[model samples]
Target: MFSFSRSPYMTALFSFGVFLLFIFLQNTVIYTSLQTVFSTGGLCACKKCVMDLNDDDWFFMRFNPTVPALLNRRNSAMRSDVFTWWKGLQSDPKKANFSDVVDVLFSLFPDEEHHVVTDPNRCRTCAVVGNSGNILGSHYGQLIDSHNFVIRINKGPTKGYETDVGSKTTHRIMYPESAVDLDNSTHLVLLPFKIKDMLWLISVFTTKHVTSTYTRVRPSINAVREKVMIIHPAFIKYVYESWLRKHGSYPSTGFITLIFALHICDQVSVFGFGAKRDGNWHHYFDNSLAHFSRGLHRGDYESRTIHELLLMDKIALHKGV
Candidate 1:
């Protein structure tokens, strides 16, 4: 019979082999877990699409300790600092009974605390379609529609422009000033700049008494009552403070919509943002010249911030020609 006792060399070789096998098994488990966590049918299912929690800026923008994204009954009270900053956005900052307003609003709409729940086993892909003129001839309709969620900003018509701006609208982000009718399937996301804005939302579905804020707004909107969602006042202030760094008077609707996607989506792709090569700013739907600098927002700074986000690989921009 051969001797059973192992030599020092043999023992060392056996231990090394075991160590290598252990490492291989460990790596396999890790890769499998990652696949399950980030699984999706879209481009953002890859490892790179995952937001880095370790990143300070991402952490600050994404995980707000004080502010929640959407307003519900549980988080109805507005923080003092957030209220002060938000109320200053409009001239008519008349104090209204916020709790009472929300109480009636929730009864009309869904009182759910959250809309999109982040899940490790799922990946949500979002397309933020802006109204920039660059998207005119891009023929990105098919590509834009491919996303899980397609968000269109203020009155971006898709009837004639369907080839460029896709017809599929999962969410519409608008304030009362930019309000548009929505189909049954689409979510009507209202970004309230004032307490009256909230009341306007309530009135639209009920009284139809509150028609105008600073200007005349639609007394009744064509939208599914249950599908309506209001952005939290604190969230608006949070974006202004954290993301914009107070660069502009407040974050633009486009910018706020982008940030909203970042919080709820696993992968975000932007379309129709920025000016054309000719350096003229206009909406894709018409020949009218639109100026980013003309509004209350600092469009230049917001553009630069968007570029910074692109540099950070946080979002993919489809610069349509």
Candidate 2:
């Protein structure tokens, strides 16, 4: 063994090298932590992150325990109070064997209690794509497709507008009047405001007798029968009463879809909701100017509610350029 005398300079150099190594290690830890937070939507672990209903006092105040998000065979029957309220949303308030329609509906599809199950260790990110013309040229297709779930509302087409609207659709929320054919992979989420809407859904796969509702609807839609989902009337009532505060006739399909995302998704990003830069409302796939005020929905109130949700940091809104 060679005996080496440790000089002061050598000792100092070793100390400095150790300090630099420590600093490098510290910086590495910090960088990794930041990356984790940013990638998981500012959460330490997305699976552990639950939607804090009470995080915002304003939202918590209106949290209704009675309203469930989805409907299955177990909770298909509506209470008398809920039935009275839900049926009033549409013009066809007359009782038309809701139980029978729901029975037939469930028979034709999966009667699972929930469409989506939240996992403690999984982050389900969703993109709720509206058909507003604002996203016409925004080129959000890639970003929309990046989400775990991409939900398209009504008859928003993605064929020619793939650059902006995206081609992937996990869920399509539509009523009878706004019905569109879906590929086998997509979930046909029906927002049934009336018993007839549910009947139309059943007929679409079976009899195809229900040709139209308020407007011409496809007698038979090309969708996966197994993947069909029906929005609970109680949920619609909850959204109308709790979220919208009974604004307009009921919650619009876009708003309902947004609230639906809030229930199942870990992170929700909305796109193409509001009007364009010109303040004119129109579909991204169409040149027709839409009059939100003329519709049954109270467009102004819904817009304000969406803004409030944005301010509360409940959901992220990607208003297109």
Candidate 3:
């Protein structure tokens, strides 16, 4: 004990530090796993997402609002760098002029037939629903159902939460990647990835078996009985590519879906739009009733941004969020 005078207290402190390090490592690993990368369709399994190309557009598409502004001047509103970069995924991977119309088409997309919900009589009211924890125990189901059309985004399993979100779902928007299998009463609106996904849907309903392409998805033969309809992304891309992207950070996948609802529907009542791990967006669950906003974390900044938007009537929120 005389030699170097090492204290037992120091050793105990070192052990505590090691315990904290263990907790930090465990939490870091779990948090990383829970965060699923958002893509147009469920999760992407594509090599290069198109082959021979590697770029992370979805990440850029998330935040950093200025990117759109930089693109606004171009015909397609995409900088040359972006254009050259995502060229492979564009409609005509060969021609630049063919794509010039891409942006303008998005701008004039409303004129396209079947794009706008043109019952001018029904244009005044709209509701934008999210997975926000605020919807639970709100009894907003009847109110939500009362709308001219109900808009749901990335939402699945409409069983117990029907009261808060609404039992009657008119138009549910989703990319095939995240499309939840719904009953015949609900429509599986196909949000296409590129021409391929859209064509795949049509082919399924009309002629071919897309099941050959995907196993996780139910065959079109089965889909016919289920009443599925593929929505052209042009309509959505047009609106978002025009105003929303320029104004805010990348519009939420759900929020963009809601704008389409507003463009076509009237008198909307939002519910359960921004749910979290706790399932509180429409806490009407049977197992446990939770009340927490769906954030990257318990109280992430983006979650707050979305809430402010909801409060401003840009969208709607539940009490908890």
State the lDDT of candidate 1 residue by residue for 235-310, as single tens digits.
8888887877787688899999988887777778999999998999988887798778756778888898788778
Model 3 alpha-carbon drift over 4 Å, by segment: 1-112, 115-125, 132-134, 180-187, 206-208, 212-215, 221-252, 275-314
C-alpha RMSD in Å of predicted model 1 compared with the true structure: 12.3
Stretch of 10 with least lDDT, candidate 3? 45-54
Candidate 2 wrong stretches, greater than 4 Å: 1-44, 47-50, 93-95, 293-295
Summarize candidate 2's per-residue lDDT along 1-321 as a digit string, tens digits.
432355777778888999999998985675555345434334323632325553545765454434677788888777899998887776774366888777787889988966355344577789999989999889999999999999999999999999988899999999889888899889999998888898888888888998877667788878998899888999998888788888788888999999888777777899999999998999888889988865678988889988988887878899997
Q: List the pairs of residues colliding in candidate 1.
A: none
Residue 110 CA displacement from its true place in model 2, Å:
0.5
Better of 2 and 3 by lDDT: 2
Model 3's TM-score against the true structure: 0.49
- Look at candidate 1 and tell me the lDDT of residue 165: 88
Distance from true location, Cα of 59 in model 2, Å: 1.6
